[model samples]
Target: MLDSLRKAAGTWVAKLLLLLLVGSFAVWGISGQLVTGMGGNSVIVAGGTEVSATDYRLAYDRQLSVMSQQFGTRITRDQATALGIDNQVLAQLVAGAVLDEQARKLGLGVSRDRVAALTVEDPAFQGPDGRFDRNQFDYVLRQVGMRPEDYLTNREQVAVRQQIVEAVSDGLTAPDAFFRALALYEGEDRTVDFVVLPSSLVEPIEDPSADVLAKWFEDRKANYGAPEYRKISYVKLEPEDIADESAITDDQVAKDYEASKARYTTAETRRIEQLVFASEEAAQAAADSLKAGSTFDQVVAAEGKSMGDVQMGALTKDKVPDPAVAEAAFKLQANEVSPIIKGSFGPMLVRVTEITPETVKSLDDVKTEIRKALALAEANRILLDVHDSYEDARAGGDSLQDAATKLNLKVTTIDAIDRTAQRPDGTIVDDIPESAALLAAAFESEANVENDPINIGSNGFVFFEVEGITPARERMLDEVREKVVADWKVAEVAARLGAKATELEKRLKDGATLDTIAAELKLEKQTKRGLKRQADDADFGRTGVAAAFGVPEKGVGLTPAPTDGGQILFQVSEVFEPAGADASTLPEQTRTSLSQGLADDLLDQLVARLQAEYDVEVDQGAIQRALSF
Candidate 1:
């Protein structure tokens, strides 16, 4: 169940909606008041509302587990703390509590019926019939370690927060003037004429003397310093390593195939579209119209219904909301339409757009797959015992090697490697499994400290003990002489380029044209025409684009380029403002987008006001203590 709980925590409902269920952290405003004299189990106190430590821990653990699964490694508590998961989870909880508190003050009471309706409406708790199923709801709740009451409470909070958001942003709209101004800025284009200053055009440099090179290396020793590397020995236990040892008989494979026969069989299915009507007479009239050579589209349009208003796309028999609708729908051939059939909703006219024949595989067809699956299952079961045995041995103070030997597992050791899994020669160490996890644990643990075991995906566990530590040291000038000289040349060239670009910029600011500057400096003039404010040009990247829009017409600016010690000295030749007529031509999508942005700003301001009125107080110590578990 813990494994099930972990896997469920990463689902879309838990990771996305649960985080948003409490509203964003930006919704909260807290004063400097520190609420004291609370029990250790209390995390936040919003007016009379208190969020419990148990709920906070659950949220924190879910987020931590999700991050670990995403990065393909075990994330430690220290890593979670460093990543600020504690603060993020606590902030969401506090904000949710604050909203609930404010809602209560305004006499906003959510009925249990409302929460129950939302629960029944959620797709997460729906079965194949596309309707609410109590069994499914309970199963999903159990998977995420939540009771029905707790889940409903979360849904109620979400409903309340949504009410607050709606109230704050109600009837919000961006003014025409505001959109016109934004359009002028966003849609404006610019033409720029520029000249490049390459390092190759700079004055040539001679090789530095020994004293100069040594001084340069001394000044930047930290850059040339060696990163700390650890020497570690580890024991890895994988189900794959023990899979071949687990023998599977043909009888067992056949039994497995029989038990999972559904996986080997496919039922015939139809792609259906249904139009449901409220009454029998309306449905019969529509069906009669279709029979009288009127197209379905015409019939729907005559009834004042758009295609989207009535179309239910692509459902199989079991997926149809009404059993009678499913039966009538499946009875039709491809491209065939059915007469109005009595449905749960009312009357439904179903159409079959496509049909798929049934498919079934014989035992011989998937014998190899079944055999492998059986072997893997057996191996996984054995690995669980192996993990427990290894832990017992470690608890008894046995060495990693001794524990491995006792469990008949091999122990692999790397003589010298860094956290990047690289040797001194920069070659990757391939033999180590779960190298990232092992390295993180090794570096965090002191030398000779017993390392905790980390889960590797589903069927493996790795444990390591750090044997030695080599403190990081700075290399002498002679040690990396070539790299030092190369770095020195780069810096010197950049400094010269910077100075040259500055001189040109000063001359342009002194009222010289780009053409004159290019001719004086013996550089080629480049022109970019009709460049939008946010457009990314191959000639001018984001930096140049920003400069083009930022500088006034006929003003000069400099942008650094990724090319070797390169710079672009440009003058904005023309600025094009959006015309008044262009605002009328703006697309509805653009208008909606701008309106949403303005509404978001309004909502933020409203939240700030609400926070001031609510007087939210968070117990930092209590939150830290709750998350420490």
Candidate 2:
């Protein structure tokens, strides 16, 4: 539970796991066993275990908190719903409940003493003394709103689930053939001889008749069509626009500096290392020896373990896992070892390795930062009033220009902007406020609809209305005569190119060499060597590289040129197949890759078996109700 809590508080990904554990406790209760649903409180039922609504809510909140921190934005309930965060959280909790049910059925569980020991080892509940402090522990529980019993019980479940995972992944190894095949496949290379035939290589055709151009345009009218474009006007409200730096006086900065003194003051922290024992008597004996002038190395050696095995990294008192060890550790001077202290794991000995003294920055040093923060806070408050005023005026059916005039903001308009923010002439539309959101709202709304103010990144909102719209229509032949002529010529060239390549392929099959053909056509034949399937060869392009590998040795092929607007006629000159090497002679990277693949396979199989064994039931209605907020 300690590890999970620590991870949950620190990372976005780990928060999901943390919430699942919290939810499992509420649904499963504190019996150290799986239980059926108690009335409608259960939101999920996997096998015999049930997940309660209280647990679901706790998990969702934690998950949302981590997401908000990770994204650096306060995600609203509507946004969370749009992102399907609630469904994702529910799925995670259900999966966790399934795993818990399986672990219990197998009689795999962690002992209370072991859970306690691990909990105490966590660094979060430690006091400044580098040991677990009961008061600090209680305070942390209160902060997270967790009962001590619930936390401990959740930790035990985590341990049991971990045991099952470890057992499934143990001793897994990939076959030698699998590794050899993958390595060789990745290393294989090919060479090709080819000639590029761009549309320019073909003789230019004469201009077609008006009738021919019209027919050509009619054949491919979609290419010469225009997209529906919208004309819109908007008022963008941003916090910075409303901020008054002059209003942030020296007095305000000083008060802010005083109020947030803790931010400027660095706390004294101690670095401590600890060794946990399985029994209190054994731990006491080791501590007595250490206190009597024996070295930690000597004590570790006596316990038949290496000193390196017990090195918990340096942490502040509150960061330490066990309260008792933290208290004893902080009381010791640098390089001093503590006697046996009752640890959650059992008996433990702690040593203070180093201490960092506290320091505080004076007001002058942080005044600039404080002033900026205070001004920003004031700006945020001002933006709220600005947003409300803008909404009220718009709701009263005032024009965008009128609303902007009343609110003292500028209204910007675009004559025409498509969904992709491009004009009919292909030039991108610019100088629009909150362009992406503005475009989205414009395109999504009908003409004259006033859109709700959209929340912009951290600082602003954009309210927009579609002024007018132009429906898409195909271009007339005369309107796009130049483009139609170009398309006709391109079609003629492509047809000739394809036919010529086919004839060349036939000639190659009839025993003609590429050198002779290139000489006859007065074209240069380029040669590419040692190209891998994954390589990006400018001469061959991606398609040419794939074609080179796809062709048989000395076989000819044709592929379209990627960007130069032509086709490539190529012949494979050589191929390098991967050598089959034994697994032992392979590189460390190869071995690691094979090992990971084998482990993934084992885990997949484990999950499949668990799914087959468990009867999973989800309350879709309950999930919907919970996420409706």
Candidate 3:
């Protein structure tokens, strides 16, 4: 919570997520397993775990959450599909289970005491008073769909796996050689010899005759056809707009002020030193010696653990390894011995030598806070009433005018916008126009004239209607002739470039020199800087770098590479082979990365993994059902 107020000023996506958290949207659709449904289902399996609807739905929600973070509140379904969340989520669950099996085989273990200690000690799972709050823990558990017992079991597994991860990943460091290679790949710069073979290089003859043009249009009829859209008017019922607000009496204000006085208090915090022993026996033995009226320093020294050494002193209850132990100890007198309590550090007795209690403020001290809280409550009551009025207005099939009149809300009219104008914020909707359906419906059909209400977005259910049509009439041929000619020329140039590449390749095979071809094409020899196999950020970006790599290894001559600027002729003046992979440079947790890379780059690897784990049988009945509705 170390966030600044200014940070949220432009965080629209964060605001959207907050709305989703409070609104509890109920979009209807049951997912998972082969059930009797119109929607067909597919299963991704690994080990013995089944990927069901429950898992898929969770994965979808998680994916949407991430997309919203990256692209703001407005995300398209296509974007989610491209990210491969559906497949990745299943793969992750499978890999997690596989790792669990491997961990079990290795006999890696975490103790029950450690789990208990960690849970109670986490500030998130604690109450305002800094004590372990079971209600908070249970609330989070219910939110994520796990019971107390089930959560504890999973937590245990997580702890054990974490230990295995720590042991394996500890000091496997990055080598200098690896860093050098990475820098080379990531930092390489390239200058290239190229020429723009724009289509303009070729002369345009004439536009296709009417007969040819008509045939081309008919062949691609699908592109010209428009999608179906709905004309809808909705009466929205928002809770914040309809509540009743009544004035509060002076007596009530005083009462609230008195009751909330403690809100102004700040709890005292403790500074402590913690030492986790290697074994419970050693911890218990140390505690026993300290309890025998021994000087805390003396006990440490006797046990070969000193103040200057490890395993030692000075703790406030809140800083104790276990919250339960802390609470019990903080309640003790100074220098008091706590019962042998099991904590994250194992069995121990704490001696709290300090005491500090929260200081509460007087009623007058918190009067301002009371007033602010009352104002918000009163405002909400007023909003609730407004919401009810809106709901009533929407009851009948009412026009926007009728709904606005009934709700006492001012109806604002907007006109002359495209499918892109749904959002109030002027942001580009990359790859998709979410407002396409509504905008098209408003303008395309003749039936939807000027009576549409403002349409709300995903969270807002406001309706928008078509006020007028601004049809995109085709431009006169003479007006766009220059552009058409330019496009035709560019295409022609690209073809010429392709022909030139073919001729160059043939001549290079026949032992042509770099200078010979250069002089023949009236091109100069161009030199480029650094290049890499994996990260091709050379001359331009990927396309240019790819062309560089595409150069023939043994045979010499210029290779034609594709580029946005123009076609580039890359000559393979030198060749560099990668050194063998360094063991020290490899990531200790390479299994998951390697597996994912294999799936992405090698079709055979992915299919092999899929076959090895799952006996996949597609049921046509289920498949058809899933696709329907």
Candidate 4:
């Protein structure tokens, strides 16, 4: 299993370097105490270059910053969990370390020119004209917890990794023959035609003798078992539950609406034709021409300028810059052209062809929007206050009871929630200040009341003391007798079906007709009429299509042995076998699949060699320390 796992892991290393997604590492107030794995176990491996607390902290901050930007808001615990972001962040760090070690071992280094080329050309780091824009790069960097140099270094590594990627993916080609076949398959639309005959058509059979049932039961005891089910009781706290109308007086609402009116109003916007010449004099001349009663498009064509203006709409002040030219353009009434306004590309003329004005809406027109905004604001304020008050009390070393009193929040207890399940209260928690999942870190033996506080979510933190931790135990047969009995019944039925099938096969082997067999069994010789080869699931929902396909025309055995779905009983009516496909002219589907197989094989070989070149020793102690939860 270990060797198999490694082989599978090696096959995937070609894709290992891709930075497909950024990680999330949000930080909440630490309360002056650093908890390791939920069990106080360290969450770090001890090998390689020494990893420090600062490194962890910086990486985490960067992860959170990236997440916040991607989400366009603060990262919630639920959102983090949905992304599995904490784990991704840690894995990002680990993969980087591993690749860095490999690069160092290979004596591979990124040259300064290469780094500069990458940085200057990276669209993320470039301004509109494609020149290196350090300010833009640094602005993004500051948000994600790195300095300019760190970002530059990271870009350098990315360039080196791209080199490796190019080596792996280059020279990968499918020949013309393959391409032709692939195109056909890509264009092919296979049709399937079939009729569905439900089991309700079958007449009911008489009750079986007790002895027969017992005999059938012996061969199929497993199916009679019932499913193991769980009943969970949980407390749900949604935002609307706690809100009251008393908190939102009409006056207060009117004030909020007035203060943020632009947000509530429909925006007046326009799309314009802009022509800029690299030479300022040429641009000014074009602007002057526009002011001489020439149409914008006619002037644009005359100037030999080519870039079309963007259709910017519903824009506010911040949407576009606040320069006088832009401001004047936005202020113009519909169908108006502003006077030539000079700027970087020399003078620029603008035309406004569309405009929508701000209008007051009725309460009915905006009730839902108003309600949601109010709810979100109230939720944020309440949750923030609750979080801050808890932190303050904990910092002051107040007892849990004292803290609860000071915060005016309920002091509550929980039923033991195992690692995989929800907390007794229906909170989907994450990053429990330990390792991923935090299951191993929490146990029943330590969960009973009468201990210290527990850390739950980030701001939704809970300091839980051990209440009662129950060790897991397998269910005894006696405890699940009903389930076992149900399983036994299903087994009995399936066994009987299997036996009937086997007997039919035997009789067919002795040269009995399908019609004769059906007659002997008092069953109809029903068949699918004019069925297509690739019938859909709804068409094949009936049981007998598979059986019809499985019977052999020449012999007693199943024909062709194709399990389109499940057991087909086929007999050859007549041979209408498809012509042997031309390997050279096979459809695009087959050729593309073959190409992918080849590429995968090459990747497999490269990864195998790479792994052979490195020495990896897992420190069991360190791994356990990091993943104890």
Candidate numbers, best TM-score first, in rank order = 2, 1, 3, 4
Model 3 clash tally?
36
TM-score of 2: 0.56
The TM-score that candidate 1 achieves is 0.54
Tell me the TM-score of each prediction against the true structure: 0.54, 0.56, 0.39, 0.38
| Model 1, total clashes | 0
Candidate 2 on 318-358: residue-level lDDT in tens? 87788888788878998888877788887778788889877
Query: Judged by lDDT relative to the true structure, which candidate is superior, 1 or 4?
Result: 1
Q: Which candidate, 1 or 3, would have the higher TM-score against the true structure?
A: 1
| Model 4, residue 545: C-alpha shift (Å) | 7.6
Model 3 lDDT tens row, 435-494: 565555556546444333333443233444444454444444444445445554455566
The root-mean-square deviation over C-alpha atoms between each candidate and the true structure, in angstroms, is: 16.7, 20.7, 21.9, 18.1
TM-score of 4: 0.38
| lDDT, candidate 1, 1-629, per-residue tens | 12333345456455433533344224233442466646666777777777888888777776676666657798998988887667766656766777778888888877999989988888787889999999988887776667788888787877887788778776667788876777787878888999988888675766779999989888899998777878888877887666652388888888988899989998777777778787888899889889899987787688788877765666656777779888897888887889888878788787777888778899999988887777777878888888888889889998888988987787777777888888766689976777677788888999888877877887688888888888889988888888899899888888888898999899889988888888887889988899998887787788779987888998889988745559999889888886663456667798886777677677556655655666666666777777667
Clashes of each: 0, 20, 36, 44
Native-to-model Cα distance after best TM-score fit, residue 575 in candidate 2, in Å: 2.5
Off by over 4 Å in 1: 1-12, 15-20, 23-32, 39-43, 52-80, 207-214, 222-487, 578-610, 619-629
- Candidate 2: list runs displaced more than 4 Å: 1-39, 76-87, 121-147, 206-212, 226-473, 506-512, 551-555, 577-594, 625-629
Q: Each candidate's lDDT (Cα)?
A: 0.77, 0.75, 0.49, 0.48
